[model samples]
Target: MPDPSLMEQLRADLTTARKDRDKLRTTTLSTFLSEVKNREIEQGRAVSDDDVRGLLTTAIKRRREASEQMRAGSRAELAEKEDQEAALLQAYLPPALGEDEVVAMIRDAVAGGASDVGGVMKAVMPHTRGRFDGKELNRLVREALAG
Candidate 1:
């Protein structure tokens, strides 16, 4: 299970969001917490810190995909909202690896027998863990491999 303190922090954020009258922020945070609650109930167990991080990653990915689709459909307002929500959600996540650092990591992965894309991902993913988006990493890996 996640550290009790971490869950407490999430609750604190939810309360702050509500108090700030940031409807979008409040809704996004509430939805995230709801998901965590549902998972805990369905599994008959509390979520681990890793599990929560994974869930956040999933939520962020979904929002990013939705934002892309909304943009393509010319739903600028909706897309903007999704983007804002995404930013807020990301704040709770670990700091992301910068492009240069990612490239360096990829290079190290390649040195560790990551000739194939899958191999590279396997090598590097553990290092990233709760930080950085997998899709973004994949793209960078592919580019690094191709060049």
Candidate 2:
């Protein structure tokens, strides 16, 4: 489980988000917390830090996909809204790994004979989950494999 202090901070942020009338953020975070609670209940234990991070990563990925689709559909306003929600969601994440870092990790995976996309992804993903978007990381890994 995450430290009590970390969960407290999340609770405080949820309150702040609500008070600030950030509807998208408020909704997204509420749903996130709810999901965490649900999973915790399912497991009969408090949610671990990794579990919370994974949930946040999933939420972020979904928002990113919606944002992309919105843009592709000529719905710039909706895309911008999704982008804002994404940024708000990201506020809770650890610092993202840089391109150099990602590339170096992928290189290490390759050196370990993770030349196939699945192998490389499985090897490198644990390092970035919750801190980096998976699809973006996958794209980078594909580029690394090709090169």
Candidate 3:
């Protein structure tokens, strides 16, 4: 048999989560898999691993935002739930770039004559794509440029 794709691995993990009675993992993986399938159907092509990763990243970001909003509204329990879900989803994402790594990339871009915010951002994003958050990268670039 062919090696399982990342999506298949995720499905297998979902099954394991179900067997282990991990409600949060099971629910999050199931929902994410559903969205992946929906996107495949809409696009009429097999979704690549990168596409699935993009979807997972978006889901995690939404959960983070929801958690923040819930906390701001004093809904601690809901906020915790959102945080848990986000963490579960994050398990499937590629490891994020470390702070030092991001800073190094920013420094390289700045040294390469990307002095302005937009120029540095444009130079750094292609290198950081799918590995770091844009807002975080933007902040780091601004700091590097300012300092």
Candidate 4:
């Protein structure tokens, strides 16, 4: 009747991946699940969906960096595999904000008197954190302040 939590969704998808014999999906989901479990154990409390989203974002970032490194090292096959894993992890994240949407948010932040880069970033990061790249957000905020 209700949508499952991210943790629950990952667990269910992990089971499905196992059943479907999708090794990449199975491995990715299991590693992500293990990170979620580790955090819960470390904190002695269950993570909220936001916490899971943070983990997903971190995992995806790691995968993307690894992909880049592999590509630079000329390991084409490994790079391709890492890219695949990154794409797989990307699916679990909330859809990214478009340029227009981000610009609108930046405008609102600036209008709210976050006229400096640091101020604008502090104002907007909470809203954009897991769904947006910090570098891109910072650039947008700078653009808003300038124009």
What is the C-alpha lDDT profile of model 2 across 95-130, one tens digit per residue?
Answer: 988889988899999999987999999998889888
Per-residue CA lDDT of candidate 3, range 1-147, in tens?
987778989999999999999998898889989999999999999999888888888888999999999999999999999999988888777788898998988888888988799998888877676679989988888788778
Model 4 has an lDDT value of 0.87
Q: Which candidate leads in TM-score?
A: 4
- Report the Cα lDDT for candidate 1: 0.87
The most accurate candidate by lDDT is 3
Clashing pairs in 1: none
Question: TM-scores of the models, in the given order?
Answer: 0.83, 0.77, 0.85, 0.94
Deviation from truth (RMSD, Å), model 4: 1.1
Q: Which of 3 and 4 is ahead in TM-score?
A: 4
Scored by CA lDDT, what does every candidate get? Answer: 0.87, 0.84, 0.88, 0.87
The stretch of ten residues in a row with the least summed lDDT in candidate 2 is 2-11
- After superposing all C-alphas onto the true structure, candidate 1 shows an RMSD in angstroms of 2.9
Model 3 weakest 10-residue run by lDDT = 122-131
Specify the poorest-scoring 10-residue window by lDDT in model 1.
2-11
Which is the better candidate, 3 or 4, if ranked by lDDT?
Answer: 3
Candidate scoring better on TM-score of 2 and 3:
3
Please provide, for model 1 over 1-147, each residue's C-alpha lDDT reduced to its tens digit, 9 standing for 90 to 100.
Answer: 855655677889889989999888889999999999998999899988777887887888888899999999999999989888888878877898887888899999998877999999999998786687787899999999999
